[model samples]
Target: MTMEPIGTWHGVTTDELGCVTHLELQDNRLAGEIPPELGSLSSLVRLELTQNWLSGGIPAELGNLKNLFSLSLSINQLTGPIPAKLGGLSRLFTLYLGFNQLTGEIPPELGNLTNLNGLFLAHNDLTGHIPGSIGNLEGLEFLALQGNMLGGEVPPELGRLADLRHLSLANNRLTGRIPSTIGNLEKLLDLELEHNMLGGEIPPELGNLANLRSFSTRGNDFVGCIPAGLRTAALNDLAELGLSYCT
Candidate 1:
């Protein structure tokens, strides 16, 4: 018996009905803005156009892809605000729009993606408070909003993401104390809050994250000693802990 590879071969994938289901063109040196006509592919389930020179705003028409579950447009020259319409893709689980020139506050409408598992909007021009509505994504495992201009207190609602494995809010203008509720993320492996304006004492409750491999709160305004529990126990064994900047 011969073994076969899983999923489509590459250029495109179609279903039994010949409807496009997956498309990938990463690092193809592709240029120009994404064609709004792409939203016409009603049956499309996955789309990738990463690491290209694509520019202009994300098409509002993409919200029409009811079947789409993954969309990656990272590392492009994309500018303007992310379409609030994207929140309408009810089936979406992974959405990557990082490393672009995207501007404006993250649409509160994105909280509609209750099925999301990974949400990456880092390295953009995003500003304003992190939406509390993001807490609705109970299935989310990865959330990255670093390297932006976002400012405000870390919403306590983020603590509701019980499934989060990686959480990064580094290199932003965020301020305020660390919410102790984050200690609830028992599955967390990497937690980065460095290079922000956040200030306060380290929360001892973070010691609950025994599964962490990398944790950092450096380059912030935090004062006092690292929690006694954090200096020893399982956390001390992490591959990287950036508390050296704590005062």
Candidate 2:
């Protein structure tokens, strides 16, 4: 049965031959929990269910889709912990679960996704330390865990992500000194760690970030003079430097 172009509730649709590979139900005002039967679609590669009113925990059955490469469930009212079963999607390259009401610690199993290039979990009610295993995503270029209740020191293992360009951990309960190893992100452009409990002097090693364009550490418990390199022409090229509320 071919899907009608008009509108439908559950947003269920299928190809003319009844074979499904890609399912897009985004912005259709979809409600209710996603059907766990969707896991039976072994060939499904992309699932877009964003911008809807869907509520309930993501089904663990989704982990059965071994060929699935992209899964986007952002901008919805989804709650509950992200299923650790999702880590079984070995081919997944992009995972967007941001802008939801998801709580609990991010599953460390996600670190097993070595092929993931983008992982967004921001704007949620998630709490717990940022997983150090996240550093295992060697291919990841964008990592956003901001706007949550996560607390603890910034993991130095994150320095292992040499390909990372944008890293935001702002507006959380994070504390402890900024890891000096952050200088390892040579490709980093935007780095935000603002509005947290982070203290101690800003690391001088951050001056080594020659490509950094915007850096913020404001609204924290940081003390001591700003790194001298931050005042140099090298870092002056930054578009923004937030140091307000620091001593």
- The C-alpha TM-scores of every prediction are 0.89, 0.87
* Candidate 2 displacement at residue 84 in angstroms: 0.5
- Candidate 1 local lDDT, 60-98, one digit each (tens): 999999999999999999999989999999899999999
Off by over 4 Å in 2: 1-18, 231-247
Q: Cα lDDT of all candidates, in order? A: 0.87, 0.86
Task: Score candidate 1 by TM-score against the native.
Answer: 0.89
Top lDDT model: 1
User: 120-209, model 2: which lDDT tens digit per residue?
Assistant: 999999999999999999999999999999998999999999999999999999989999999889899888888999988778787678
Off by over 4 Å in 1: 1-10, 231-247
Model 1, residue 189: distance off in Å is 0.7
